[model samples]
Target: MIIEKGYDLRESLGVLWKNKNAAAIATGLVATLFSTMGPGLIVMNAAKSGGLTDAQAISWLLGIYLIGGLSTMFMSLRYRIPVVTAFSIPGAVMLAKILPNFAFSEAIGAYIVVAVVTLVLTLTGVMKKLVERIPVPVMLGMVGGVLLSFATSMFTAAINMPQIYGVMIAAFFLSMAFKGFSKKVPPIVVAIIIGIAALGFFNLITPIPLSLEIAKPVLALPTFSLRAILDISIPLFFLVIGVQNIQAVGVLMAAGYKVPINAMYVVPAIGTFINSLFGAHPAVTAGPSTAICASPAAGEKKEFRFIAAFSEGVFWVTFALLAKIIVDSVKMVPKEFTAVLAGLAMFEVFRSAFEGAFAGKFRMGALVAFFIAVTNLSILNIGAPLWAIFLGLLTSFIVERADFRADKIENSEAIEAAK
Candidate 1:
């Protein structure tokens, strides 16, 4: 016998568009993008500074953003957790230094190698052991240090344009006030509205210069060679493996979820492989980027974060497909206005990173981690995150071992007294 049944796609669809889901997903998307845009913009500028032409830089930016967003969607679904990732800021920094002397194709070759090594570690579970050994203090410190530069830039911009900074500060407080009075309304969104209005009121915003359109994407194939691997891959690996992965894992744990390291590594690594083919850099897990997906406003439902991530990919891809229009639209805003928002958005992340490191009993350990991260040392080609972890664990181990010995001696004395 055959059975026929009727189903309502609208039922499932309605749940997603309901007041709760709509508010949650909307808030999550806004927070994630706003917080991340600072770093994304910085990475774009870094690419330009590194000698990439406008076309090349935008191609890398949009490609990585799209690939990374989609990768997060898959991982979030598989893990049932909000695990968002992005291109490593440290890797980008390394690129800024190396790209001047080397060809872009050579850089792409290096990115591919990093992704391969990351995949092997994840598939073999070797990366999990390395992740487990990381001390919390070190992770916190590494995050704090990496984000420090951006935070400083906000106030620096305020100095450059006092009026814009003044408005931003007002917007920050207004956002806080709104969040307090109404739990549903997100402060960042409100702040953004106010910021834009302020810019408009003061006549500071630039008018549209030309019609906006999405620029064409330039796709390329990988050219792997021994020289390319040596020049690009090794350094890129040190930066991504050492810093970006550590901070992303820490952010997840801090938000009260402990995802398996393999999920974190493999998903983004695969995305990076895809990105490399398109002449984009390797993407890694984003700490602040995930915070948006993990926000309370994203929804009480378990899948809200994943849903939010899924939606973000949709929006970003849409924006990417209209790259020229999006770029042109952004051009209409004064450069200083973008700078102000970028700095303001990162404030929360910077605060949390420092707080996590120094606000506990492990303040001493956190301090050690901070110094190591800020120093930005390299050992055998490995970078600061790994170094911070090494120092933090070393400190913790010594302190614990000393306590263990002391306990043993005290127990022996007590046993003798009983005898």
Candidate 2:
């Protein structure tokens, strides 16, 4: 399919309207909720623990969601790919842990350093070259390992809340079975409806009082500290690039898109720099949320699937604008419900990654990576995903080298005999 050159709002809206279906809307809503509500709450809580005032916390949240929305929108339109951007969850967790020790300005300074480093890596093409060198099996294995826990949690969560989750799971499979009968309704939509109905029937969902409040953005001038740079900036940079970006590229590739690595890094790096000025964490390509937008259920046609991501961006902006109301509403839903939904949504992605990782000659290497990733092991403060890929590649080289040499020698012997 030919991609349009420039971003046009009218064209985007038209695609959204034309291709809009239950699946697309469901994907957008789920992705938006997952990206903003939970992560936003975590960041706010963390900031509060770190001695940030209510106003400061609100500024961080608003900057994150607002910039994330705008960046995702721009990238999706520019590339005609479902590229969703959001704050790094791991980064936020790390910030929460370390922010209590440093001044907020110091944290902001560290964020700036991370953004500058990311931008430099992208512009120098170092990141792109590194990504290219990573074998596909290792990449997919790492992604599959990362997602394994989430996918398996569907069953454990269902067992804990048998009635609601059981119905939801049944509805998911039933919807999948019945999808041929209805083009407009997908399994995810059906499952959402079933889950909601189950929640209401069981009186599990509470009604949240709605209030509208605009978030005020606050700018905190950064103060650089060697300590903050070492403790926060460097790790944050590696987490975003190594773990988040790797999964982002893995998901998109699993969904059959060849996204430019430089474009991937450049857009979010700039967004992170801008948002950091307002006291938000660095934005990176969202992994789990982007999977929803890239899923086949998001749209029937691959060419127009980006509309789902665009719709998600719209929801993100709307949520940021109505932060108070959206957060309250999201809190009304049970956590288990959201987990099941996320797991179900990601099941296909996990399946694809698993298949891709182990499909060919590097099966053992892929398996090694997959298990290591599933362990979620971290060494030297770096995320397990990166190590999984590195170790997996090393194993593949060691195991497959002999076979390669034997094949070369056999080919040489055959050539000599023919001569």
Candidate 3:
């Protein structure tokens, strides 16, 4: 099914209105919750390490969320699919490491360079076609590998803080035990409520005064540096497209969505340009968030899944506009709670990832990719996801020659038949 059709303001708004439901909204809320949790913290830590002032850090958050939120909403509505996007977490980690070595101005220049490169690929449609050719099994393996950490972190947090996670986990399972209850309440929402009640009952809550702090975003200027280009731009570019973008693409395709691949690349390239101006990393299609929106849990009607993405965009935009208030509010919830929610939310996607990875062909290659991703191996600051795809493809090429030959023969026959 294609998400493409003529844009109609009245019809578009009506579609969203008609699809509004508890499951889709809860999916979006969980996705947004994950974003504001660890991902948000990492942004702050990266800014501190980069020596950015409070105002600059706020601007970074603003740029990250606003561009990300707007892009997500636009793509979901425009394409009529759950086209979710977010800042690259690996990009943030890379920047944290590289920032101290080079000036932030130089880093901004690198961001511009990478965004341009992404845009160039988008305009030519090279990346989308190339990405489409990748075998689904290997790609799924890489996706599973990339996401394994997020899933495992929940259990880790639960081990450390059983008081909170135990209650939440019990609630989640209880919700799932009753199909009728889960359909109405959403298992995730139930978990959140129980988690909160547990926190309050144990007197672990630290209440803060409700107040809105204006996040005044400041403009930043860029200056080119050859060293920064070599050190940052090349790797950053790969992370944004090769790693971050790949995960989103893989997850959606695995879920049987006819992704608007070209548009996905193009929109994020534009978002990268916008995000770079205010010190945030590039916005690429998001894996976890997209998975949440695209999964069967979003709603019974697959067509309405895009509403989850749109809702996520709404949350992200609100978070961006009210950065200080939302950030503070997010902080009120325990990190363990967020971690468990994220981890639990991803179980369906993770299961699908593994199923696709090992079911039919290229199992060896896919397994290798999954291993690399789960290990978090990095080479020259390049994250494991890229390496996983590379090594996985290589292993398939060398070890599974017959599979490729059969695929090639099938394609050739189809082409000849068409002719």
Candidate 4:
């Protein structure tokens, strides 16, 4: 296994102090706000699907942010890179679909299984090889299939609460249309701020607990089920490896940051294992937040970017401590409103996944996978996403072997160039 050694807290702290600037701190704050505004609502939406009580959901929230925050700081300081990470948004969306079909304990079991599998890969020092072997188009096809509903849900949600959804949607697009404003304020924040005001004006906001409620997060035991392992764990594993960690690596690399890839896999695996015990999903080197933190908007000085990650981690820990407040806040809003926000939050990811799935080689296989996954089919307890991958690859092997050969040649040359 490739281990990143020589982490000195004192030196990293010194670097943070030396590089502290308004832009870096603001960038980190924006990343944190983006996560809480939309993805946080999505997390709540997914938990509700599993029928979790308030306390259980609070525990889930606390675990995810706490572990995720601490790990982000650790990895950034240890490697001097902007390592912004958290629980997988797409994985959580997929979980929302599968949770309705399985017990919560079984889902937790699947989470643990995924963490364990990734850890094993990390330890064996074959994580990169394993990830590289998966056909990118096929993997992305399955991802697009599972995530289609979350992005499309916004339209259906608007049908029910047109006023609130309309305001958010309008705000979202207006913010996206302008680049200067988007650098400071993310589109989701604009949408959410305006949407909340509209909600109050229309009296869509319900009367719920809005008082200080410190979270008393509790842990639960996991129950393993073969059905959930196949249906949930396998698909989630592919997402963490294929989508989250790998995507984060590519984003950072493009930003001119040479991160320790094995450490990236290993650290998130550790966080995933711990958080699953607290009823949270897999932790990952997150793509969206990493992109934000690594952007030039963070600061002109690339060396100081890790401080942005530090700022995000501190905010996450604070949010983790106030998980109950967040849950209570979500309760005050209508379910459809939150659903729309979550759906909108995932729109960018959905677009990327769709393009990656169908805009290249293995088109026929990806098409098959995409259609199969959209059905959310289940056979002998295994979910369609996993089957989508299998059948997608099989289709390619039979009728599109040339695509695989091309991919292999490209991968080999890339590996050689890296070496």
Candidate 5:
């Protein structure tokens, strides 16, 4: 039995390494790794900014990935969709904004409360109702809004680090050209390698002062309090559900697959509940990252995504096991490489959201949604996504109602003429 199990494991690795779908598979994994690492690092920094110690930050990182990723696996299985759920990056942004004043314990309390409320929303079906009411255009706008900052950052980085940026751009163009000949090597991987090499030659990378120490997660027990929930949970909830999930819906639908909103709600809730128990913040599906993975050109065969989830799960475990090496490697890589690489990887995400928000018979509604998300205004601490959908739906309803009335009048006239 042991030998058979080992053989199966080896076979799985062999299949992945020697995949016929190597280009697509590699693209998805490369993009996922790059995109997730940037945001994951940001979350760690945000935790630190919130006064969490290095150990706490590590715990938060490990816990978030484990809980969020495993739950996403089950969600993909249940929905038969290629959804890669994650903790809310915007929620982490909010934490960056709110943590200076509040205690980390309170932030955690709020996370738990939000998770509970989210679960309640799922059970009561209110969340599903709200999701259904949202129009596609508005959802696209919300997605665009979330990714706009990240995309803009790439250009900003190019200006800041011209040499590294040039290497990354060259890598992108070369990858695009080589793709016509061989579809195995991913552009993002090529970009990372080129960028690192360029930076190393320029003496930008300082040899990391290596200290060999194993970091272990220190688990904290949950202390749920109403005050903590009210202050922290509500804002975090609004950030994840409103901004994050809205974009997530847009990506799924834009790709010609409509996930049941209830499934969407429940998956994150499951992720969050597990995260809450393990002392991590709430989790949400990563629309931009998953969109990066689901590109048709990247060989996004349905099987590839399941393989991605399986691989990502393994990646997380391996990363955990070799935390020292992983951390060291991350530190060794220049930040400029990561920035441009991430933006390039998500180019498809930007294009899809743009098309979804502006194209088809839904142009007017989509335009309104786009404007609202770009404006980045908040109403009563609620983000722009809520309002974008609200306006899009209102406009769509009004136009549809007018069309209905006009059709009735036309039918009446036809009947009179026939009589």
Candidate 6:
């Protein structure tokens, strides 16, 4: 039995090593680093607007990435899934709006409150039930809506920097066209190499000074206020639960994984709660990154593909430890190049989401939800995703009622004729 167990372990490791190729590594890096670009900027801007000193702002960001890395590493290993976790982007955007109004302590307090509320929801199974209740089409529509801008950004990048972005775009297409010829090659990886080469050739890539500096955690005691709770905490909780977590689960399902919804929610909730004490934003399952990790390009076998996520976790931890180096390296790359890369990386997700959302009985309702989500309409300070679900369901109920009535009438007529 011992020998057999050892053999099994060796076989698993062999599969993991064999499958962990350049494409998987590049995917993990892109998912971990590129996905955080927008949110990291938001956090910095929010910290600055909230009257934090330069040091405090840096500390806030460091804390977030550190905790985020640790949490993702732990959860991915624990579940043997590519469960990537990060600070919420919509939540960060919402924070940037509200954090300016409150003192830094109060903002920390609000973060704690949001985390606590998330934990409560998870423990009570409220979060799981809420996710299950949302129609799959509507959920897909919401995911598509949220990601639409990122997809469109590729064109925007080309318009902004045609020479650089054009090359990147060409690389993407060429890689895709030839992907069938080599199972080991991932198109995104090819794109990244081409992008870097172009940057170097154009003298556009500048080497930033980097050093091995570990980020220190910044702890702040909570100072809760009713206004802060209402403005920051509640909205953040809703955004994380309704937007981020829902999207994460959708991505997993679309990738053909049987997601442990309850465990997924609980793990992130606990991570967020713990991280809040150290001045980190709420950590939740990351959508775009998770999608990348769960993609078939990660590995040929579904069972062993988890190594892709594990590799991502390892990258996150490395980035956190060498935060300066990683961030500086990423910054050295042209913005347009990064944008092109992100858009290409997320193209598959967009395609899958659009197909799933519209190819169903609730097409019209799904369309309504898709439009609302894409517009990013917020009502009563709530995010658009929640409103999309509500309005979509309402539309489905009202419009589909006629179909129900018609079926009933047809059944009655057949019965009368038989009699």
Q: Best candidate per lDDT, number?
A: 4
Ranking by lDDT: 4, 3, 2, 6, 1, 5
- Where does model 1 exceed 4 Å of error? 1-24, 35-37, 76-81, 89-106, 180-212, 220-261, 289-291, 303-305, 329-336, 360-419
RMSD of 6: 8.5
Best by TM-score: 4
- List, residue by residue over 253-301, the lDDT tens digit for candidate 2: 7777756567778778888888887788899998877887898878787
lDDT tens string, model 4, 347-404? Answer: 8888888888888899889888888899998876678999998899899899999988
lDDT of each: 0.62, 0.73, 0.75, 0.85, 0.61, 0.66
Off by over 4 Å in 2: 1-64, 76-114, 180-186, 215-261, 275-312, 377-386, 401-419
Residue-wise C-alpha lDDT for candidate 3, range 107-189, written one tens digit per residue: 88888888888878777757654453446677678767766766677888878888888778777888889986665455776
Q: Residue 90 deviation, candidate 5, in Å? A: 5.5
TM-scores of all models? 0.71, 0.64, 0.70, 0.96, 0.66, 0.67
Better of 2 and 5 by TM-score: 5
lDDT of 6 by residue, 1-419 (tens): 10011124355556667666766666576676555544555565456447666446556667667767776666555555666877776565445445666777887888888777877777776765555444556556765776677667788887777677877787778767875632345666677777788789889997878766776656777898877776667656765776677777767766666566766676677777776776667888887778878887775666655677767777766655654444446667766665576567666656766886788556677788778877765567655665666677688778865533453455345334422
Q: For candidate 1, what's the RMSD?
A: 8.6
lDDT of 5 by residue, 1-419 (tens): 10011124455445556654655546546545654545655565466558776667667776777765576555544444456777776566546545665666666667767777887877786775544333445456655665676678788888887788876877777787876532445566676678878887888886878775654565656666655554457646765676577666666666655455666667687778667655578888677656655556545465545445444544554444444444455566666555576567656657876886676544676677667766766666555655666676576666645533453465345334422
Better of 3 and 6 by lDDT: 3
Q: Could you tell which candidate, 3 or 4, scores higher by TM-score?
A: 4
> What local lDDT does model 3 show for residue 160?
82
lDDT of 1: 0.62
Positional deviation of residue 177's Cα in model 3 after best superposition, in angstroms: 3.9
Best of the two (4, 6) by TM-score: 4
lDDT of 3 at 281: 74
Residue-level lDDT for 162 in candidate 1: 66
> What TM-score does candidate 6 get on C-alpha atoms?
0.67
